[model samples]
Target: MTRAGTAPAVLLVVVGLACQEIGASFAVLLFPQVGPLGMVMLRLVFSAVILLAIARPSVRGRSRSDWTGVLLFGLVLVVMNGLFYLALERLPLGVTVTIEVLGPLTLSIIASRRASAWLWAGLALGGVAALGGGGWERLDPLGVLFALGAAASWAGYILASARVGRAFAKLDGLALAMAAGALLSLPFGIADAGSALLRLDLIAIGAAVAVLSSTIPYAFELIALRRLPAAAFAILMSLAPATAAIAGFVLLGQHLSWLEVVGIALVIAASIGAVRSSSRAARETAEPLA
Candidate 1:
């Protein structure tokens, strides 16, 4: 794709990451009342409803492989969201996001043959290490483990989404997968939130969280993934930790020290380097044909 074509995908990713962080901050505010499991349940249930209503996916005519892909995608979504919220319950948003980014960074590094890709990965890892170095003692080990689990699930989600996107037409696969996720999380949601889940105000907030965090970002990512290579997509998503830090400062009153600021800058630099590298590689590939 031309630079012009790639620009929109980049913009979508930026917007999606911003929305996701903001929604996450909002979810934190509700966590005390509903708990993490309840919050995940609300996000999945409402997001599933919105996507299913919009896509109206057909159940008929899907092959067993197609269903399998969708099921796997849904399972990944469930695990990713659950673990992320659980981590959020114990860790600062920025720190959690920084650790969770390792999953995609690992994916990108393994996918690339170039040594320069390893440099970018090293820079990103150094930044994350700096960000967490000072406050590691205060952070719960269990929370860190949860974030790592979310990271693994996120990597799975990325790979599964690409396959499911190809298998089913225009959001149908996403819709089905989201529905399956909702069903899978429903029991936990009920058990945790209880009657609080039925409150009108909580329901309204849950709906907004679903739209901001799940509906919008997922749609943007699914569309962007169709156009962007997985490695490129992962690099673009490197912005998440920086955005999460900003959201934490703005919404959660979490202050960052100079080291953390430098960490964010390093991650941003690595993302830019990755994008430029990918673009240059694309240009070189086309040059021979031209």
Candidate 2:
């Protein structure tokens, strides 16, 4: 697409990611009342309801493999959200997001056939080490572990999303997977928050969180993906950590040290480098045939 045509999509992606981070900040405010598990359950339940209502997916003709993919995707969603919120309980939003981004970066590196991909991997490791310089004394060790677990689950989510997208039409797979995620998280949510989960005020906030974090962002991203080149979209997404940091500061008053800022920049650079390398490789392969 031309630069003029791509501009709107770029705006959409930026707005979507900003909204997602802002929504996360809001969820953090509710942590004392609902806890991370409750927040995850609430977000998943509301997101599932909204998607199912809009997509109205039918399961009549799906194969066993299709169902399997959806189930696996749902499980990944459950684990990813649960661990992410758990990490948020103890870690700054910017730091957690920076760490979690390693999941996709690692996946990209693993899928690439280029030797230079290792440089990006090393850069990302250096960033993580910088962030962990003071160890558990400065940052919660358990929270860091939870963030890493979320990162792993995010990688699984990416793989599963691709499979489920192939197996089902439109948003049907997403809706079904969201429903399954809500179900899987229901028990843990109830155990954590009990009857408090049913409070109307909390439910309202949760609904808002779901819209901002999932429904609206997903809609915007889907539209942007159709209009933008894959490489462009990937590069745009590499700005997420910076956005998260800004959102953390503006919405939550969470401040990062200079070291943390440098760490985040390194990770963001590594992510962008890995994506650009992959994109260049793809283009070169096509150029040879042309």
Candidate 3:
């Protein structure tokens, strides 16, 4: 695609990511009333409802493997969102996202055949170290752990989502998986939210969060992906930390140190490098022999 053609898709990606961070900010606000797990339940349940209504996926005649893929994807969604919200409770939004992104970065590194992958890995390590700013105690250890768990779950999510995508048509797989995730989260959401879940206002905000965080982004990305290359999309996704930091500052009054800023920049840079390397390798492998 020409540079001009790619511009709109790039903007869409940025807009979607910005919406995601904004939704995260809202989720953080709701945490006081619903708690983290409760917030997860609200987001997933609402997202599932919206998706299922749109897709209305048929349950009949699915292979065992299809069901298995959907189930595993659903479980990954629960773990990824649950851990992410839990980390948000303890850490600043920017910090949590920066840490959580390491999962995909690690996956990219592992998949890359180039020696440059190690250089990118080293850069990422440095960035992580910089996040501590000579004192790891400044960051909440438990929150960091939660973010790491979220990170791991994110990697699993990528794999599981791909599997489901191949096994089912269009949005059918995603809708079903999201419904399954909502069902699995019901116990914890109910336990944590209690009577607060009964409030109409809170339910409305939860629905908004689901739309901003999941629905809008998914729609935008689906459109953007048709125009943008996968590598370009991955590169654009790396900007999430910066957007998260901005949302944190504007919405939550969360501030970061200079070191942390540098750390986020480093991670973003490394992520882009890794993605480029991987894309190049894939292209080379796909080239026809002369």
Candidate 4:
């Protein structure tokens, strides 16, 4: 893609990420009312409804493999959202997200064995240690564990999503997967909040969350991915913590410490370095004859 073309795509990706951060931080407002599980359930329900309405996926003619992939994605999606929301209940937004990045970063490292991969691994590690600081108490070990669980589930989502994309065209797979995820979340929603889900305000908030977290982000990311290199996208994603921090401050008023800032910087540096290395490798592979 041309620089001019990639520029808008990059901006779209950034905006998509920003919307995700905003939706996540806004979820805090629901903590006292619906609690984490309740909020997750609502978000899933709303997201599924919206996507289904848009995609109108039909399972009747789909292959068994399609069903299986959708199921797998739904399972991971359930665990990811549930655990992420749960972690937020106990941990600060920035801290929880920083820890959650571990899963994807680890996946990224495992996908490659180059020097850049190792450097990213080391930088992410240093960032983790720096964030954790003196001990686990700074971030709460249990909360961190939940965040890690979310992260691990997120890794599964990434891989499954890739497969789904290959299996089906035009993101129908995602819409179907989201529907499955919503169904899987139904039991939990019933168990955790039951009739509370019927409340009008919560429903409104859930709809808003669906727009911010799923619809807008998905649309922007889809367009962006087509225009930008995967390496560039990955590098841009390293700024997740910083966006989380800003979102938390603006939406939730949760502040971060100086040490936390340092940790974010380390991770960002690692992400940038890794992207540079990967881009260089890609360029070498594409080099013309001398």
The clash count for each model shown is 0, 0, 0, 0
lDDT of each: 0.84, 0.91, 0.95, 0.82
Candidate 4 error regions (>4 Å)? 279-290
Best by TM-score: 3
Candidate 1 residue-wise lDDT, 160-212, digit = tens: 99999899998899999999999999998889888897799998999899999
Candidate 1, residue 91: the lDDT equals 83
Instruction: Indicate the worst ten consecutive residues by lDDT in candidate 3.
Output: 281-290
Q: Candidate 4, 2: how far from true, in Å? A: 2.5
| Minimal lDDT window, size 10, model 2 | 129-138
| TM agreement with the true structure for every prediction | 0.87, 0.96, 0.98, 0.92
Q: Is candidate 3 or candidate 4 better by TM-score?
A: 3
Q: Is candidate 1 or candidate 3 better by TM-score?
A: 3
lDDT of 4: 0.82
- Which residue pairs overlap in candidate 3's backbone? none
Give the poorly placed runs of model 2, Cα more than 4 Å off: 133-136, 287-290
lDDT of 1 at 282: 61
What does candidate 2 score in Cα RMSD to the true structure?
1.3
Candidate 4 shows a clash count of: 0
Q: Which of the two, 3 or 4, has more lDDT?
A: 3
Q: Is candidate 1 or candidate 2 better by TM-score?
A: 2
Judging by lDDT, tell me the better candidate of 1 and 3. Answer: 3
Give the per-residue lDDT of model 3 (tens digit) for 188-279. Answer: 99999999999999999999999999999999999999889899999999999999999999999998999999999999999999999999
Which RMSD values do the candidates have, in order?
Answer: 3.0, 1.3, 1.1, 2.2
Using alpha carbons, what is the TM-score of model 1?
0.87
